[model samples]
Target: MRTLAAFFLCVCALPLWAQEDAGALAREAGAQLEAASVRLAEAESARNRVRALTDTVHAYEAGLSAMRAGLRRAAIREAQLRAQLQARDAEIAQLVAVLQTLTPDEAPTAFLHPDGPNGTARAGMLLAELTPALNQRAAQLRKDLSDVESLRLLQEQAAAQLQTGLTEVQTARSALNQAMAERTDLPQRFSEDPVRTAILIASAETLDAFSSGLASIVEGDVGWTPPEVDDLIGEFPMPARGVILRRAGEPDAAGIARPGILLATRPGTLVSAPTAATLRYVGPLLDFGTVTILEPRPGTLIVLAGMAVSYGKTGQIIAASTPLGLMGGLPASNGPSTGGEGGGAERSETLYIEVRENNVPMDPLEWFSTEQDG
Candidate 1:
């Protein structure tokens, strides 16, 4: 009877042991799942950070390129001014020689000369003949002097601009180095369909066509979803701080109605995102220079063109206030009204901002902060 009781006790203990083992296994699985989730979150954060840094580096590079171009232009202008000054000097010297030769060395007196009337009459005739020439030469000299002064002023300005550009390039390079140092290893969220992307890039002739192709790909992808950006409109800041040089609907130099607002910004000025957005395209687009296109929401796109350099790859999501790129150069207030001469130190940069809804252009003023409206 005791042996039978022992067997029954062992049988009951077996089930209890199995149950404890199962619970332990379940706990282990739960712990692993939690750990994986944490790792994923960390990876996502790292990726975003790297993306932001990449964009900043691109912008700085663009700014540096612009500065260098400006420097080259300033140097050219300086050479031209020097040549003009040399020519003006020669002309002035010739005019002075003629004036000196025409003028009398001493005053004539009737008491000191026997042929006084004849001499006086000849003197008067000579003076009359030279009067018009003297006046013309004097006027020409005055105009030349003014021009020389203007040229001198322009040279000083150009020198200052060149120095500023050098400084900006140094600062941008340092910042770029720092950004690179902060980079972390992170897995990409989506695998790039190289074949499809290459085909699209090759076939698309215009920016609009390229944009359409990208939109189709984004929509077809099941893993990606457009972020809700409408709620953040007007709550964000402008990409860069600068004066509005031109507004939407204004006629540009090409006589085409501008679909965007152009901001005259300082050279190497920092540019950031106004709101959370997904980068769609970043590259050169015809006469627009280096362009960056972002999708803040589905069916809505924001275009930033006229950059010297661009950052970030396609499909990367960026947070608000993230650095995108820097402005290329300063705008020339004294230059022609048309977008200032390109690649010159005297010329300033214009950041073109355009907002599109369903591929149709819209005024960007309504979306920017009140501070930017002016």
Candidate 2:
């Protein structure tokens, strides 16, 4: 009977041992699930970060594009104002011509007589009428002149603002580039997390391509040189004709250094090369809107600033007098052309010409091929 009892006790203990073993296995499985949950959370966090960074980059790029377009529009407005002023001038000239024919000499003493002195009284009355009319006409002309002046001023202000805007855009771009650099290693954090890693790679690749494209834009092509003009050995490139509204080294209203010459040119005028070589990079530059940088040979980079429009692309081949772009902004009907041989445009312009020999800035005046027309 005691042997039977012993066997029964052993059987009961076997079920309890089996239960303990099953519980231990369940705990181990739960721990693994918890670890997986933590890893998944980390992956989600990385993906969110990548998405945010990508969106920020896109936003900045869009802003830069908009700023460039705005600069172009502002330039066009300046041209339009010049045309309007010219029209007013032409009208004033016509009025002056009419006045010259109407009044050949000073009024005679007889015409001023108040008594009934034959037809002299009638002439006096006519003079009275003409006097007021002429005065009114003169006043109108003066008003028109004032308007033209104001418009011209507005154009100058706008151009300045546009330049500032361009600078801001460039600065913002630089900031974004820095931010991207700082976050360069953030993608690596996702390496162990497969889902996040995929997202990170995609975002990084997109950014990398964008940066590469920008870099390729800076590596310009050959520059064009003016034949028979050996004197412009170190000058920045310029159009064949025009004035410089803003000279290099001139401080702007805000006392900022305006680094390039702003050329004033006629609308639809052909802008030529200062020298001849291979065309290099032609694209939008920081604060310069549409620009063409020609690397004639290996060391020289001639930058054409403030294009109202662009016709070429990165790595495009161009020639001297080649139409890289239209005279951006408004082309003046009677206003000064900014792209000519003189100082910049007759109207408002902020030409930011920069000559770099092996990436170092040089004074453009040293190599100016033409006389100072401004």
Candidate 3:
């Protein structure tokens, strides 16, 4: 009976211990998930803040651009006004000189002069006209001075506004950085879910690849050109000489249509921006290692391909010729040492370039000018 009792007790304890273990794991997972959630929230918030700040900076930059334009306009207006003022001053001086040369028409003194009876009426008429003319000149001078003061005030106000906007950008950037730092603890907390974490990591990696691809397209190593119907827009720089394996809009060996030019480059060379524009998208595509889209100007899009390394972010405004990443592979040599076709192919890296106008694919070759026909 004691043995049977002992067996029952063991079975009961086993369930209790199992429940305890499950509960502990549940608690740990919950905590981890919560931490990750918080971190994600913070990251999103920081991203938002950064976006707002970027917009603010753009606004300020736009304002500054306007201010520069206004300044030019103001300068032109001021020059014209000054010219007018100078002309008026010169006229006044000339009039004053003439006045000095002429005697002020005094009431005709018949005792001192002969034939004075007819002269007084004409003299009175002349004096009336001269007095009004002198008053008008003085009023114009005052108006010109007032206008100059107003223009100066406008210039100062525009300058102050532009500066304030610039400061706001910096403030926003600092806030975003703080948020990012606070959220840095989230990844550690989520380490329990290796599968979910891997998914997230993969997604991030895909984004990075797409971003890199966008940069490689701008390098223009491919025999790139826009469609015959499109016009030249802009481009960025590329590192290491590369040959185009597949042209943009061309079919691959499997008859797969590609969106951008593909260049065989060193494996890990940095990519670069083709033009100054906002990054519209960064992510994966079928067969494409990575893809990135940039709107360099309004309605103009550039696509890059084969990018496994990228340095820019979506919605970010990158400058023309800015380094997106470094040459990402081994140095090229004369002999095909190991893996690929040409001597350069021994190191297998590629950069692809694509251009789009109004979201429609165009040839990149039309935009890029080079002494080399390639």
Q: What C-alpha lDDT values do all the predictions have?
A: 0.57, 0.45, 0.46
Q: Backbone clashes per model, in order?
A: 3, 45, 34
- Model 2 lDDT tens row, 253-283: 8887654566665333334455554445555
| Per-model TM values vs. the true structure | 0.48, 0.35, 0.37
RMSD of 3: 32.1
> Model 1 segments beyond 4 Å from truth?
1-173, 177-191, 216-228, 330-347, 370-374
lDDT of 1 at 358: 87
Worst 10 residues of 2 by lDDT: 14-23
Count backbone clashes in candidate 2: 45
The prediction achieving the highest lDDT against the true structure is: 1
Q: In model 2, which runs have C-alpha deviations exceeding 4 angstroms?
A: 1-237, 331-346, 372-374
10 residues in a row with least lDDT, candidate 1: 14-23
In what order do the candidates fall by lDDT, top score first? 1, 3, 2
Candidate 1 lDDT tens digits, 190-225? 434666667777787866677677754443343446
lDDT of 2: 0.45
The clash number for model 3 is 34
TM-score for candidate 2: 0.35
| Candidate 1, residue 23: how far the Cα is off, in Å | 75
Would you list the rank order by TM-score, best first? 1, 3, 2
Error of 3 at 38 (Å): 28
Candidate 2 C-alpha error for residue 138, in Å:
31
